[model samples]
Target: MFVIGIDGGGTKTIAILVSSTGEIVAQATGGTSNPNSIGIDEAKNELLKLVHSLSIQNPKAYKNVVSVFAGLSGIESPKYKEEMKQILQNQLPEIAVTIDNDAVIALFSGTFGEPGVVQISGTGSVTYGLDSKGNRHRVGGWGYLIGDEGSGYAIGRAGLHAAFLEKDNRGPSTEISTLLLEYFQVKQIDSMIPLIYGERARTTIASLSKIVMLAADHRDQVALEIIKYQSQQLGEQITALIQISTFQLEGKIPVVLTGGVMNRSDLLLNDIVKTLKDHGINQVEVTVPKLPPVAGAVIAAFQAVNKNLDKISFQNRFLEDYV
Candidate 1:
């Protein structure tokens, strides 16, 4: 039999067809299927297009498909999950369909579907944990306005705040002011106001995180402090999850760190690790996923049907073929 797995998020969607033996038969990518970003109809259309593309790539494999698992962002509520599942099932009448949050696939990507925690820190941030009993919990991911403390937007906004403080002589001088002026191609810091409040305000602010990372790498005190504080916030989320969940404090717990900001900045990763250690959580085995979250969706498909994939062999083949 064959299975279909999908990972859909705010930016893009990936779908893959896999054989029972763990061979990836066909794959396709398309625009975002996130219903929250795009309307539900558009999201459904995007997903159907990608799945149709996969079928066209390998009709024989698609014909044998038995199950489909879709891990999507912005479908946290049970109402949304049921709505998407019904839509997919209506289109593919004979197949079994499952829908869940994108965070589930992210955790599976790192833990091979075992119990673990996944912390995502991109333009926004969120922390999710699954205990051994199959109980799941989440913290943060409230978006830019209220939460997302350790996210790229937060770091960038902090950098911008520090620059303004320096300009007003209310804070110590830092390299971020010069960096922001140059980054925005403005002759003076105030000239960036209009550009920052433009249509892509959130992304624009998030992009400034790279400048903050650069400044921290150069040992700028303000940048380092910003990173330090953000790392602490992230660490607190992890620790809080552990304390609140069924996870044993002394047991070997896997922690998967993914997302653009977490992946790119070793300095920030190190700081987070230090924060965890300082909090006396030594049993956490932190790692970056070798495969993307879509792989986890595939794994979930296999699990849904009481099937299994050889973890090491699947990883080797997938990295060779897809990465």
Candidate 2:
């Protein structure tokens, strides 16, 4: 039997086809699958297109794919997952389908199947934790308007707030505004205000994330604060999950950091590690060469169907090194 792993994100989707022995026969990427950002029809279409593209990449392996594991971001409710499961099932009735939050997959990839916590920084932010027994819990991911603390939106919004504060003499006048504008080649701040107020601005604001990186590079106090603050939020999320987990993950679970933010800057991840260490997390270790989250989604799907993550480590290493 073959396993399919998919990472469904806000902006794009990645699919990897793996043989039972852990060889990645094919991989494909496509447009975003976030239902909140892209309508369900568009999301489903993109998913179908990507999934089909995966099979098309290797016709021989496609016939052997017996199970599918997909983890999607922006799906907050069990109802949403069930609905998505139905959709995927309808598309391929013979294949078993499993769905989970995008962060869970990230955690799996980050830790290579060792139970742990994951912090994802993308258009949004969410922290989730899992234990040895496969129990899962989460924090954040409320979306851009309400929560999503430390996400791309949150970071970009902080950048703009710092700029405006500097402009108004109430906050630090930093190079972020100029840096952000330069990143987008915008002529005026007000221009962004209007664009950000509109639908397209969400995507536009995401592009502005470079401004945050630039600020951190230049040692801007606010930028540093933002990065550290976000790390703290993630740490707090991990701490909470660790505290509440029923499986007793206090000392052994690996702490995995993932997503765009974790990859973009080691600064934030270092800060998070330091903070956690300061709080007495000695078993802390980093998962190098991030495993694609879709692998975890695939693992989740497999586990959901068979109710076992025992081979999770083997599958993770297979795909992580498979690439």
Candidate topping lDDT: 1
- Model 2 spans > 4 angstroms off: 20-22, 35-45, 74-80, 90-95, 184-191, 245-247, 298-323
Candidate 1: segments with Cα more than 4 A from true spot: 20-23, 245-250
The superposed Cα distance between candidate 2 and the true structure at residue 183, in angstroms, equals: 3.2
Per-residue lDDT of model 2, residues 26-78, tens digit only: 88889888888777777778778877888788988888777888889767767
Number of the top-ranking candidate, with TM-score as the measure: 1
TM-score of each prediction: 0.93, 0.82
Clashes per prediction? 0, 3
